[model samples]
Target: MSFPIELTAALTGASVNQLRRWSRAGLVTPEIRPSRPMLYSFRDLVALRSVCYLRSEVSLQKVKTAFSNLSEHDLTEHPAAYRFATDGTTVVVWNEDRFMDLVKNPGQFELVTINDVYRSFTNSSDRVVSDFEHPRENLSVAPDRIGGWPTIRGTRVPFDTIADLVADGDVTADEVPDFYPTVSPSAVADAVSFQEEVEGLAG
Candidate 1:
């Protein structure tokens, strides 16, 4: 599913205005929909979030320069097919075939992972957010799932779908199972608590 600009802003650690500016500048644009509000796909989330993370490590000019070089290569792989590693001051792009220091050299791929919403992407070589399977107990995100949004482990129901249900006052933690038999009371609690925790961090 596509996300509205506001939610996209939170996930990317960017303001809506900045995201718009980037889009207009052809830096990172969302997947286009014919008649819908401008919405972002999961791929767009990864790219934009990467820009934010890299910007924190290096200067905006450096990030842009790296992206300028990145645009010159063929990007036929899935948006999250590539991997990266960074120290506080340097960034490198890695793939099975080669490695390129983004600041000193450049490459074609871009992918992201998150912990503390950013470290997993920078410090770990084994994890890719697109390939990620778990966020919390009873929650999973797999490419085969709905846009890879975290979902109730065995079902297609998104974790946020349940969290929003209770947070909106339409249900209680104990009442969730009546609506989704696969979701136990504890899963409901997990969903709500997870949502609260993420929103707090994103805020």
Candidate 2:
């Protein structure tokens, strides 16, 4: 079922103001009522969760960049599921090969483990947000060690990778291109602008 903006924000741990800003920036546009109230679909919630995962892991700019690569069809029509650690900050989406990997090798993937969430939350002294500063560091270990895409709020990833694609306007949403999926280039540019505007506020 589709969730309203407020529920979507609650589930994603994002502020309504940020959602509005994201819409204005064209990262995750929602259907607008005649009075201009935003109406979000279940797909919108999934997309927002993806954005939240990106933000929690890297930066808001990069999240927007990914959106720019997606056409309206790709952004709104794709059936993506958002998975989060019980802590809430660690969010990942099941998409394409990654989605297949989670299902095929459930015990092997870090993000797909729901068990970890229970363990993490149970041991916490305070609420999860307080501990967002310290996320589960070892997402992947050993020689097979893989890296997660950097998000502004959750993890660190290079900005240039996404910047180059969007700046060149080389990606589209129909099929997964070889370009990085973490963030769309255009979204990155807008995120930069948004960051500047909210430099001092409690964003």
Candidate 3:
């Protein structure tokens, strides 16, 4: 499913302006953009998160160079599908066999694996009951369901899935119950609010 730019920015912890700039630079483009309202897929979120993390540690030019080098390799999988680390001087992509350095030169700099970056991203996605109060009473987190993504209580429906629908203009917050009869409008509101709060914290 595709999500609007606001939801994409919220989930990825990247500003709307940053997303636009990256899109212009061919770094992370949305899956749907046939009109004024653009939409992005999960893959785009992963790529944007990677870019945001790299830019935080190094210069934008360095991040661009690293991504350019990465494009030449066989690691074309979605950024979320793989793990990565950086030592402030170089970016490293981890594969099943070994880690591939993205930088041009290989020097004797101490390599610091930023595995926490991926962890932070995952943690942000994993919502739970504690994230909200009475409004989110129906929210839950089950490791066995949907690979641990936050879902409605007693159901496998992810909160983001509903939020995405709302952001896409496919449904209004008041009309969410029609799509998910088991969920209340208040719960839907809570889910969206909780995610926005998470995004604010991430930012």
Instruction: Give the alpha carbon lDDT tens digit for every residue of 114-197 in model 1.
Output: 532333332354434332455544577778778778888789999988998898787887788889989977567657656875
Q: Write the per-residue lDDT of candidate 3 for residues 8-42, one digit (tens) a residue.
A: 77656678888888778876778667234878876
CA lDDT scores, all candidates in order: 0.66, 0.42, 0.64
Tell me how many residue pairs clash in candidate 2: 17
Backbone clash tally for model 1?
0
Give each model a TM-score: 0.54, 0.37, 0.54
Candidate 2 TM-score versus the reference: 0.37
TM-score-wise, the better of 1 and 2 is 1
Give the TM-score comparing model 3 with the true structure, all chains together: 0.54
Q: Which stretches of candidate 3 lie over 4 Å from their true place?
A: 104-203
Please identify model 2 stretches exceeding 4 Å from their true place. Answer: 32-35, 71-76, 79-95, 98-203
